[model samples]
Target: MSSSTLFSPLTFGDFKIPHRVVMAPMTRSRSAQPGNVPTESMATYYAQRAGAAFIVSEATQITPQGQGYSFTPGIYSAEQVAGWRGVTDAVHAAGGRMVLQLWHVGRMSHPVFQQGQAPVAPSALAPNAQVWIVDEHGQGGMVDCPVPRALTVSEIRAIVNDYYTAAANALAAGFDGVEIHAANGYLIDSFLRSGSNLRTDAYGGSIEKRLRFLDEVTDAVVDAVGAARVGVRLSPHITQRGMHCPDMIVTTLKAARRLSDKGIAYLHFAEADWDDAPPVPESFRRDVRRAFGGAIGVAGGYTEARAQAVIRAGWADWVAFGRPFIANPDLPARLRNHLPLTVPDTHTLFGGDERGYTDYPNAG
Candidate 1:
């Protein structure tokens, strides 16, 4: 057995996971078309990586309106729930746990996916980001996002209800828990930042007002399920897609405190992973640790050594890996044994068949 802290057991309330190596959520865009349902191939793909302590599933839209990219799965429909049931069953049968990530793209979307209607956001702002869109002829490419229409107060409440329904649906689909995707310049993230959310209503303006949407969604989800099975993700350091805000770090810390007060199971930080990305400061990590008492997890470009170092520093309870898990199905075992990892095919990272998805063999 490995002696590293990464191999050590950790508890998130009711869940006493065997290791601290988590499988971070990644958008692979390989769901079945037309209905955007999870497929048997997806079940196999997740089952192959059951070695992770627990898997946080790819970002799944809570409602049709939440979808941004082509072929990403949804959790709102019965067919989608049934499809995910198969995936959860496969993961559980393989002796692993998984959580569904609830997502809404907000302004990071195109009208093509919005039924020719403008995408919705806290304010009418464009992300200056592009999302992968598939044309009618089955070709996919990046497309620019247009300015979104501002969501009214009633509509904002409706989205919170949508999150509640999605959380309940996730439980019905056999997932162990659910993670609110409030990071990455998505709907909830936009509301938290001043730049994207210029609304003067109860949902925006001051930092406290800005956190109302996230608080309501968190409350709704916690009420739908329970505090023990809910996790919230936040990205305070990310500045891309016009998400930068002078008060983001303070806002994130305050949000963390609120989430902690709500008794959520964990707080996950989705750090920027680009090669030139600024480092997530240890001071910030310490501040978050003080703000939230629950298990704290982080995901970016983490190698085994880096993961181990973070855990040893006492700043994080678990370290989530994204790309490394793509090519290494038996990642925990490989890290435990100090085996070389297989690099994933970059071209096949999103929207493809089993070639780069599940064909990568586990180390024997």
Candidate 2:
């Protein structure tokens, strides 16, 4: 497949980039301890990968209650906001556009990260997922997720406000835009899928009810920042952590239409990347395009050639590369020149120092 489409310049919202390669947000869990703050070293990490058309920062919690994993950054505090400013400044200084992903882990969280209280979700069911947590000794390990408490209608409204505040903080931190983390069995995804959201209130039961949280969150975000600067990420086909619903495809198409009606800037699909993950059907892609006449981004285990083919075929407007960018800071250049790529060290992927974080060299 030709790489012309992948290497060509593209415009997303008010930001124009040299190419169509987006750097997907991968949680490295390297934030500073005590405050879950981004650091200068994190800035260096993003600055080195300025070659990406746009960089989506790893999921940053909107509030302490939204946190699930250890060492992830947050956007709800002044010090944390200042910490993220360093990252955004570095990316901009390197001539790159970047966005922050606002997240709430919901039922995926452990009580340890939630002030010894149960995590909040649309229902009290456990997703049977595990979250990374650090002990007072500074050692980190995975623990089973506890059954969460379902949020009240009032509580749901408060979280929406938290997302709005997070969007404002992202702008204050100097990001070009913000991507709402509504996918991957997180808070919003929990609401959207039936397996997790069993509430009978206005927020659950039927598909429309299940979609209420997403609609409210999107509306609050689009109102905070203009529609052009707001993006939403979804995983219609991913079955991770009991997120699969029989009507996932249909529900996602409806969600796409709703998001499109709101005039969102883009819709990102976090495709399943497991070796045996289900393939995104071509028919579903066509339906998504018809339903949402906006830029579409797909991320999974896409190679340069595969990404180009999808873009050329109009299945996606752009492609986001995740783990590849971890080991190849200048990934766009390497892909452009057909240079050999390096494999990322899995050991240092999460909660690590500079070993596999900023130590990767450009192709020589």
On TM-score, the leading prediction is: 1
- Quantify all predictions' global Cα lDDT against the true fold: 0.93, 0.91
Global lDDT of model 1: 0.93
TM-score of 1: 0.98
Q: What lDDT is reached at residue 102 by model 1?
A: 96
Per residue, candidate 2 scores C-alpha lDDT tens digits across 1-364 of: 3344988887766667788899999999999978999999999999999889999999999999999999999999999999999999999899988999999999889888888899999999888789888788888888999889989999999999999999999999999999999999999999999888889889999999999999999999988888899889999888779886888787899999999999888999999888887788899999999999678999999999989999888888889999999999999999999999999999998987899999999997
User: How close is each model in CA RMSD to the real structure?
Assistant: 1.7, 1.4
Off by over 4 Å in 1: 1-4
Per-residue lDDT tens digits for candidate 1, residues 1-364, read: 2244999998885577999989999999999978999999999999999989999999999998999999999999999999999999999999999999999999888898889999999999999999999899888899999999999999999999999999999999999999999999999999999989999989989999999999999999999989999999999999889998999999999999999999999999999898888899989998999999899999999888888988888888999999999999999999999999999999988897998999999999
Off by over 4 Å in 2: 1-4
- The TM-scores of all predictions, comma-separated, are 0.98, 0.98
lDDT of the structure predicted as candidate 2: 0.91
lDDT, candidate 2, at 267: 93
> What is the number of residue pairs that collide in model 2?
0
